[model samples]
Target: MYGFTIVENLQKIDQDIKRQELKYHQKRVMVSKEFSFDAAHHLHCYEGKCKNLHGHTYKVIFGISGFVDDIGLVIDFGEIKKIWKEQIEIHLDHRYLNDTLPNMNTTAENMVVWIYEKMEESLESDQKDCRVEFVKLYETPTSFAEARREWMTHE
Candidate 1:
């Protein structure tokens, strides 16, 4: 009976250690990437300088959150770029925003939301434990907008 009790306690201790390791590995981490594009846009109803068609060296930062995988990376940098190339870069880079996203105004606020949604769709099929966390858009060097998945809704 003494030997059996000792074995049981050791097994319990081992299980607890494994559980803690799993929990540590499963904790969320965030990774962000930045991209640049040149695009032109004009705000339709704006009463400011944005009303006229103008070009900007736009900057975008994308954030993703998830558990670190066996490779110890939240997500690969190249993978993020590939996703952007497919989901956003190809259409928006060097294109007129009004012509590219005709359904909506090309304000930074609206564009940020659109980027988040597009990235979300592209990441939906990911087999990893990751999701889009946030998107920041810079229409100018200092002027920008941001969106987070928790604050925006999909229809």
Candidate 2:
């Protein structure tokens, strides 16, 4: 009985090691990160509560789909934060969205598209293997808007 248990445990450990090795060699991965910012904006030519100036502690989620390099990562999360903060947050955080993006109507739908564009601009590589996959923005606790690269491409 003791010999049988030892063999079973060895087999399990070997199987687990093989799984980890396979994961390390995985070529493609989906990486995502979430961030939040506070900003105020008012919709133009709209008939609703959003038309009046207001603020929201907005939440944003970014997704990247890419081929993992030798480091076994699509991109570092810290790098993502730095890119977002420099490219987008500096202009939007604690500022009026209307003034920052004058052409945009300051709606969540519009803002998400703008964010996606900024992310694309920040990336150094144009390789198709890695790219911005999606953006999810929450204007309110229950209400949100999202854009996906596949959806945008069709449009």
- What local lDDT score does residue 20 receive in model 2, on the 0 to 100 scale? 50
Best by lDDT: 1
lDDT per residue for candidate 1 within 1-155, as digits (tens), equals 35543454554544665544534465789999999999988998889998999999999999998888754677888989998998788879999889888489889999999999888888877637778889999988898999987888562
Residue range 54-139, candidate 2, lDDT tens digits: 99999999998888765467778888888888888998899999999849799999999998888877874434466788999999
Looking at model 2, report the run of 10 residues with the lowest lDDT sum.
1-10
In model 2, the runs with Cα more than 4 Å from the true position are 1-23, 124-128
Give the runs in model 1 whose Cα sits over 4 Å from its true position.
1-24, 153-155
Candidate 2 global Cα RMSD: 6.1
Model 2 TM-score, all chains together: 0.80
Q: For model 1, how many clashes? A: 0
